[model samples]
Target: MFPRTLLCLAVFSASTPLLADTVWLKNGDKLSGTITVFDGGKLLIQTKYAGAVAIDWKEVKTLDSDQHLLVKQDAYAGEVSKSLTAADDGKVTLANGEAPKTVELASIQQILKPKPIVTDLVWKGNVDLALDYQRAEKDTDDYDVAFKTSARHGRWRHTGEGEYNREVQDAETTTNNWRAEYSLDRFLTDQWFWQGRINYKRDHIEELARQRVVGTGPGYQFWDDELGAFSLGSLLNRTDYEYRDGSKDNFYSVAMKWDYNRYLIGKKVEFFTNGEVGKPLSGVADYALDAELGLRYKVTDWASLNLKAERDIISGTNDADLNKTRYTAGFGVAW
Candidate 1:
């Protein structure tokens, strides 16, 4: 009888160690699985019954993780990183000590599980093309092309985007403007980051040959969730402008940028808006404004419908405008 009891104890301990994570929902549904991500807005899980499933993070009322997780904190929680195990009633338990501390779940911005080596970095983005032509009358032609991509690995992120627009009427060039920019962000905390950016632009109609801006500064993310996101930052940029008239100017400028995006239809439709104000410390072009407002609709897994209106303004420059606006609509392919 003693030998049989020892065998039963060994079997129970081995099986219990193999048990997966557990998530209890508000509606009394329980899921036994592994948690891939819990971003408060979205939750990803893997289970034997469903293979892989995603659920609204808000619907999860309680969760128990057997593995250690790196947790991001909100401002109210002192912005400290914590290792966590279980969450209950909007409170998460620390895993480090025998006497565990609890943190408010609302103050937890991100909960990261251990990732494998193959998934250390991830990338995604889109490319768009638009063309127009009218050959019968005065031989009118127009074309617009844009591409954007972003990558994330650990606490570092990178983004690159560029666009070109051109129009011709009666064989005369009326509009020619293009800009390319790249940015890098390093996370200092859950809500704050250090950022660096560089940009190059050219506008023929504005009688500008080329303009380049390079800068680095700190940035803050006010809010980021499934519904919407917003961020604002300021940078000191070294700018150089070359005009078609062979005049060249260079200066240091302070630039403020605000960007926001919102989802209207749960990954089907979304809105994006961004604006920038740049003031030169010493140059002919005193200040410049650049902004974009757009919407993107997911048509398929790899294709999306896009509509955008852009505005550019330059004050105290060679050729300034009260407001210059251009509208574009097209389909974009993404991967």
Candidate 2:
């Protein structure tokens, strides 16, 4: 009986590497893990012994895996193989069919898992919330929640964001507002795309009670890789505003929008900023701006602490000019 048990244990131990993704280093080190992503010259692997590990792609001698992966080659438009097979140094065999192909390792640009329906889908997003209360003479309470998400499959991408804020002091509501926006992008080429977006804002206590905007324009993606992403857009918009005193204003505007984020310290810390600035063509308002900037420190794989500052401004409204700034710190979860 003891001899049979020993045989079973040996079989399991010998078969472990066959089921995992393996990376062979030039220095004769072998790593058994699941490949998470490879971008910005860093290949990330999730290992059981250690946490997620980032390895410089240049140092890898070769890699092998049985799972379907999407591998993009720099300046190459050919269809990628379904899986990878280890080859000689500085090369890998792409397992396509009866006819496998070999390619130089330096030509590989990105590596990621393929989705079931969409072979090339990259999705990422986050949600954050903050709350505050005071028991002093003035008794105050504040709540804020914001979220942004994006998904890209093939040539199409969808992005959306929303935020809500409220504050109360001595049983009186001082602020109540919420806003949402959505945009769609169809990639015309690798880095250029067209976008159409719609936005709505509502404030219960402010004189500028409601706002609506629809815009379309061109955008450029600077870089989107393992380290971070940045994009800038220019839009032409038609906007309408409603005031608490039953007044209304309409105008045409042109705006510039920016979205940017970066990972630091091996992706344990993140810095992100996004916002829009616009000038009204018809002078319904001279200029308007809405923006936020923040930093997040990851405490665990999915939990984080964040600090953020937000600014909103709308000058030259018919009934009132508005300017507001807010700061918050809180904990949240991220994927």
Model 2 Cα lDDT, one tens digit per residue, 157-199: 9999999999999999999999999999988887898999999
Tell me how far the alpha carbon of residue 235 in candidate 1 is from the true structure, in angstroms, after superposition. Answer: 1.0
Give per-candidate clash totals. 0, 0
Clash pairs for candidate 1: none
Evaluate all candidate structures by whole-model CA lDDT and list the values in order.
0.76, 0.89
| Cα TM-score per model | 0.71, 0.90
TM value for model 1: 0.71
TM-score of 2: 0.90
Q: In model 2, which runs have C-alpha deviations exceeding 4 angstroms?
A: 1-18, 25-30, 74-82
